[model samples]
Target: MSRLLHAELTKFRTVRGLVLGTVATAALIVGLGLFVAANSVSVCSKGTVDVECPTPPAGPGGESVRDKFYFVHKPLPGDGTITVRVTSMTGIITYPPPNHDTIVPGLVPWAKAGIIAKRGTTEGSGYVALMTTAEHGVRLQHDFVHDVAGLPGAVSTGAPRWLRLTRVGGTLTGEESADGVTWTRVGTATLTGPVEIGLFVTSPSDLTVHNGVGGGTAQARLSTTTATFDNLGLTGAVPGGGWLRDDVGADPEPDGPVHHPGSAEESAGVWTVSGNGDIAPLAGEGPGTQMTLLGLVIGLIVVIVVAVQFITAELRLGLVGVTALTAPGRARILLAKAAVLGAAMFAAGTAAAAFVVPVAERVLHANGSRRPFLPVPDVVTLSLTVGLLTAGVALLALGLGALVRRSLPAAGLAVAVVVLPYLAAVVGGLPAGASQWLLRVTPAAAFAVQQTEPAYAHVIANYVPMAGYFPLPAWGGLAVLAGYATLTLVLAGVRLRRADL
Candidate 1:
């Protein structure tokens, strides 16, 4: 078997197109990765400018940007209400583009700052809030996902925005007032567990961009909202004199004033409120991988062409029968063919990723974007994923060549089975709903292994089906591809051994 494998490897290495194709695949991977990195740019919340420097968003489970803020509260494990008046709400929406972080003066119209009745300080918890927007007036939001609009105009210090939240078992109600009396119902929400009722203030701390790959992002720079709760009021299960203060998911900058976002002036009738965090989602409208899809699609095409030609050329010249006899076992010849193709593809893919992932962050940085870093271990895992995806597809193609013994039919079937579904799901280039089930059942599931940013129920990223995002996890998706290759290769071996063609 070793000698047979060696012979197959020798044949593949001697083929100039196969060797050149490997080089071309590597070139495309690195070249395209560099292209995306070079073209992309980012603005930091602080004054830092780097190319796509992904602000390691504080959401622990990647649900929403629920980290970095202040929470002053008393535990109300059951039904409760917390009411307060918001005097004046103001903030700075900063845009620190690649070169410099420019503070944008004041909050945008939709910027929210107000009172919250949360499930807890931990991210992804169920909760609701009655907040004042910069322009849209009062709003009600729940679970970091649901948003309901209220009174449609900015409230002033003189108008006096009165906010209230009342909990009834699983249901919570939000209300707003003008003169600390006539409270108007804003909206309501439902939470299933223990609740934390408190005075909370938060800001956008990150950008929510959508135009394109490097669109103009108006990221939040700073938000220091100072509101006085004069006619102090807490109804139902109020625990006085023991209020816990937390930074939520963020703490004060090491050198900033006020620890835990202004937590030093909580007197009998005073609470200086400020928050530097985003209760929002990350924008993943485009590809986040370091050009893997760009490289994989083209590489698969080139390798498929080479693989089909490699086997069919032998069939055309009547070398298949001769090689079967020479190799002693007909299945051995098929195995050697697959071994050769798989090995070559694996080498090509690994080489490409080695060059692509290492310098990815640096490339983005050179281009003045916030670059996300991948550790060496992660880089190696990603490299292995690339290699495995290429190798599995190669073996599948080789099996198709053996099954059909014709170049075009083998190539077409191989691509339709392994690559077409991927393109369909990724770009909707094919018919609608065609790729969903195809990816689920076909070898194209392997593409899921390349997915870095997964869709979250709470995070509102562009979880578009046409965006090439597969619904399977990395290894699970790769297993589907491997299963197809193994089954086809086994059938190909049996056909070669028993059928005289």
Candidate 2:
């Protein structure tokens, strides 16, 4: 066994394709890794530019609030109650767009009508102008909004204006007040979970808020608009339970304090708030660090092709008969080839993973995404998995070669079995479960290890038919592929024992 294994290893080392494939795999992994690392460093250094940058709010633990100075004409939704306090009295806060044909054009789909406050208006409009039921959608029926009494009129700019949102049961209560201490209820409304709350500003008539360029032109047509916000807050019935706050101040010098009327404020749009609910755990970093274990399977297939060539090329030259006569044990020769192929595959897989895993992690991190660093356990599992897959493909190739005793036919059969199922899965749109199962039975399934995401899991659960469901858990998927390889090897071993050299 030792002598046979040594001879097989010696033959494998001499193969040109095997040597070249190893070199190419290493180069690809390293080059990609460096690129990803450089990008990640650039992303991290951008500081304030990162959307996910941590910015804690001022004051102690209190209601988290986001302030947007300039809001476009769009509705805002919330899981709880919401209030809209207008600081500017000159802008038009209308329910129906000026035109009936087009809904607020360019608005995000999630936008919903809430409250509108115009400037320079009194009696019907004041410090707080409430959005009527006709304006708000059906979801806000249970929620309430209130207009404050003795509210001020519109002005160029001075102090900030504020609105408060408080959720009770399944209802929201909106309140407005001249000062944060005294408040009046607006109206009530309801909203869905993980609700979104934010402000929007639109041009009463294409007026720029900063320079006040268009304000004079649309002055006669402009409605009452008020602007002054301070002490913005949010709260719920539960004690010490609400979304966290992160306060962002006015954009500093250089650019100056220029405000666009119909544009979302840099500090406002789409703020993620954690209310009285659980935050989902971040996904495990390691498993998603690199390509799936399946990538190694492809490398194994290449090794197996080489193994098949090693075996059948000799057979085509009538060397197998010569080898068998000298060795006298066909089983030993078959075992030697299998051992050689498995070792080559294991080495190649380890090297490829060493190169690929780090690069993958860098790419994810550069994008402000987290992933696991390659660890010893993952390496071991991947190496074992690749070894098993390659051995199976190699054994099958050897058996086919022995049966056909011709290099071309055996090579073609090996490639077909290893490559055809993957092509079918891609082109046929087979259900993931069926595809995975078919892949498990074929050499292609070994590539499943390369998947870090729940690609197959999502496919099986969401797309596959109920009766066809055969979803394998991540580790289980690897096992299933490994099992196929083992089975092929066992069958090939049996064939080798019986076939004539």
Which candidate number has the best TM-score? 1
Provide the TM-score for each candidate, comma-separated.
0.60, 0.46
Q: Please list the residue runs of candidate 1 whose C-alpha ends up more than 4 Å from where it truly belongs after superposition.
A: 42-198, 201-285, 290-293, 429-435, 465-468
lDDT of 2 by residue, 358-472 (tens): 5556565656653334455665565455445555555666666665667777778777876566555533455455565765666565545444333221011121211112234
Those runs of model 2 whose alpha carbons end farther than 4 Å from true positions after fitting are 15-278, 281-301, 367-380, 383-392, 423-437, 453-470, 490-501
What lDDT tens digits, residue by residue, belong to model 1 across residues 1-501? 887788778877898987887677668777777777777765544333233334444332334244445677778878777888877766655464553556555654445667777767776566677888766778887755567878877766677788888889888899988887798998888876677778776665434433222222223334444444555467787666767887776543435644435442566676666666556544454555634336667778777778888777887787777866657786888888887888778888888887776776677666654435556777788888988888888888888887788989999998888777776666554333455577778888888767665564433344434443566777888899899888888998888778664
Candidate 1 accuracy as lDDT? 0.69
Q: CA shift at 484, candidate 2, in angstroms?
A: 3.8
Report the poorest 10 consecutive residues by lDDT, candidate 1.
209-218
RMSD of each: 9.6, 16.0
